[model samples]
Target: MSKYILPVSVFGTVAGCAVLLKQYVTGGRCPSKATIHGKTVVITGANTGIGKETAEALAKRGGRIIMGCRDMEKCQAAAKEIRGKTLNSNVDAFHLDLASIKSIREFAERIKQEEKRVDILINNAGVMRCPAWKTEDGFDMQFGVNHLGHFLLTNLLLEKLKESAPSRVINVASLAHIIGKIDFEDLNWEKKKFDTKQAYCQSKLANVLFTRELAKRLQGKLRWLLH
Candidate 1:
């Protein structure tokens, strides 16, 4: 019994340490308690994962959340859940298939016509290590959905964003961008054998580069953040 106790105590200590390490590495949680009461936030791929969690967080902060997702059913369900949990009736879901340029354009147009302001745009939709598939516009699936889609959507909504002024555009990128290399000659991956992992990295790198260039262009007009 005495020997067992020591082993059990050691195991508990290791487990506790692991939890603390993970918390530190993941950056715990948002420190600011500031609420976005009247702000409007649009998040892509808000049906699940980080996107859904982000929508819920902003909703709890009193922001009007618009979830754009490829899956309408899932998006609607997520919106309902967020509204219920946060008691924010302003939460809504809209169809946004990032794989298709036409869909992106239509969604942007609707937002411009219907919404009064665009306070924040979160480009959180992304495909990681997907098959060697092509998007509706005949581009690499990962690249198209992860970068180009958000690029076009952001540009289309630029006028509304500028009109709203003091607005923000958050591009969610991964550290994988460090290893990413853009093959400018074959942007569509048509020439070389497709590597899904490399494709994803390239897309992430594109997100980082795009955000940097956009920040320089928008300068004082709009704020940009890369995560």
Candidate 2:
């Protein structure tokens, strides 16, 4: 009985530690009771993964959610699912392809012309270690899609964001940036071999830098949401 007791206790302790570790890794839930009754939120790549989950959470809070994705069908389906789950009818989908500068511009233009205000702009879309490819504008795939696209989109929407003062810009950077170093001389990898891992890291690092610089520029006018 003593032997069995020791083994059981050890197993229970291990299980408890595993649970705690998982919670720590995934982080905790939002503690804010803030509801977005009339706020408008634009989330890129909201059709799936983290972006989709974020949209659902915001929708549950009663915010007007605009899902920007390359695939309209998927975006609409995701929006419908979110609406059904959250009971928020303001959830909708729009077209935005981060791989193309033209598409980014068009999306921003539509938002500026149609939407009265931009409450939150979430740059959640990104690509990870993928085969070397260039964007429509001939930039590295990871950098182009992850950093440059959002940079241009944010800049284009700056006026509208200012008009909707106290707005928030959220850039979803990755832990990979901790080891990233931006190569100014070979940003596009034209002078060296393409390394997918390094490319992803560089893009994430750009996100961090962009957020820091933009925050400085925004000052008291707008808020930069950091995770």
Candidate 3:
């Protein structure tokens, strides 16, 4: 890690820890105010972190959740936890590993067979601060998992989103992306040395670009939903 990045990360961590400490002290209600009743929410990496929390929130709001994750055991556990906490909500995991294109293809096929339509798609699976590597399809690790994986998944499931008619795709991005630019030349980090944070930012930028492009196209299709 770079010298500047280390201090910044430490500061961010400390700030997060302070906020968490304050929350515990406050004993806040954090009441459920989600708008996902009767909606089907698909959250990748739903076994942990914000993904797990999102599924829980959706469940509390009477939403049916489909978890897309690589680890079946962890996914099942997460589903059980959600059900245990919330009251008889529908929460289950589907197999998905974003590192492989074949897995992405297979996941899309499985979704087609099972679900009639997807109301909300959260492309939340990502790798952060990991060692550099290339995917089986020869893309950069973070780029492959965070950007291309979601891009392919979105394209495959687009028809379902359209069928649902009021769907939303929320790809999580971070401020780390502000310094990144699209490197069309070495997008896969083939020639240049790979940096973990840089790779993350690039993938996040890809998501931002993708979202803008897709919203432009879908605006015409979803015109009726507008008030």
How many residue pairs clash per model?
Answer: 0, 0, 0
Q: Per-residue CA lDDT of candidate 3, range 1-227, in tens? A: 58799899999999999999878754566675656767888889999998998798888888889999999999999999999999745888889999999999999888878887788888888998788887888888899998999999989988888898777788877667778788999998778888888888898888888877887888865321100
lDDT by residue for model 1 over 100-167, one digit each (tens)? Answer: 99999999999999999999999999999989999998999999999999999999999999999899
Error of 2 at 204 (Å): 0.3
Regions of model 2 farther than 4 Å from truth: 1-22
Model 2: lowest-lDDT 10 consecutive positions? 21-30
Off by over 4 Å in 3: 1-35, 220-227
Q: Write the per-residue lDDT of candidate 2 for residues 10-96, one digit (tens) a residue.
A: 999999999999788668777998898989999999999999999999999999999999999999999999999999999989999
Q: TM-score, each model?
A: 0.92, 0.92, 0.82
**Predicted structure 1, TM vs. truth:** 0.92
How much lDDT does each candidate structure score?
A: 0.95, 0.94, 0.84
If both were scored by TM-score, which would come out higher, candidate 2 or candidate 3? Answer: 2
Q: Which candidate's lDDT is highest? A: 1
